[model samples]
Target: MTTAPADATVRVRYFAGARAAAGIPEETIRLAAGATVRDLVAELGSRHGDGLTRVLTACSFLLDGISVRDHGITLVDGSGVDVLPPFAGG
Candidate 1:
């Protein structure tokens, strides 16, 4: 039988400037169960320091391929989040 996990495992993808600032294209973050997006974001900011925190401020997020408009949304185990910074073009 399958058992529930004690923590939520989030797969995070960073794009463009966000990726550059984070120095990694993607990563797996383990957060406490019932933790919200806000909590995850806060943890990231604290983990990566000021440069990433700045980039995160201007970036938009997609949770499991859907845009996340609410930071309070709770994260479940195996959630995938994308951090997309502004892209420059014509």
Candidate 2:
């Protein structure tokens, strides 16, 4: 895993199955300066194990309330990243 500078952090919020997989509602992920969303996902997958990695594959992401489909997008410091797993319909 790449080491992050002390001040670089991204807040990750997990929902539904993602929350279950991560075993937490939210967490602060340390990242290298100019880290992208893909970097954060990769790091999370590594830290949380296979369950979260699986959940992440099907999950959608929101960066600071805006929907993001590209994992290559760069994450700003103190940004909020929400992980939303697919929902079942009635």
Candidate 3:
């Protein structure tokens, strides 16, 4: 399990649908120790409003370019997390 600091700040990159919803490509989210990606999403939802929930649920997490299928993945300071939603096309 990875431990985070009380002042930990992680860089989050929003892609595809998530980017469109967030209206930004990236942001630095602060959290307490042991904060997970899920936690970050919840926090973001609160800041951005309830509509974020619908979009966040469809997004997958990535750490340093590696997919994090596990929702329990711990987040720490300086970590780079990517939010990627499934692409829809013909």
lDDT, ranked from best to worst: 1, 2, 3
* Candidate 2 Cα deviation (angstroms), residue 33: 0.8
Model 3: residues >4 Å from true position, as ranges? 1-6
lDDT of 2 at 63: 96
Q: Distance (Å) between predicted and true CA of 70, model 2?
A: 1.4
lDDT of 3 at 51: 62
Alpha-carbon TM-score of each model against the true structure:
0.91, 0.89, 0.85
- The true-versus-predicted C-alpha distance at residue 89 of model 2, in Å, is 1.9
Give model 3's clash tally: 0
For candidate 3, write residues 1-90 as lDDT tens digits.
975456659898888888888878999888888888778888888877766668998888888789898877888788898888888898
Among all windows of 10 consecutive residues in model 2, the one with the lowest summed lDDT is: 2-11
> After superposition on all CA atoms, what RMSD does each candidate show versus the true structure?
2.5, 4.5, 3.6
- On the 0 to 100 scale, the lDDT of residue 88 in model 2 is 100
User: How close to the true structure is residue 60 of candidate 3, measured as C-alpha lDDT?
Assistant: 82
Q: Candidate 2 residues 1-90, lDDT tens each?
A: 976554468999999999999999999998887789999999999999999999999999999999998889988778999999999999
Instruction: Evaluate model 2: give its TM-score.
Output: 0.89
Candidate 2 C-alpha error for residue 28, in Å = 0.5
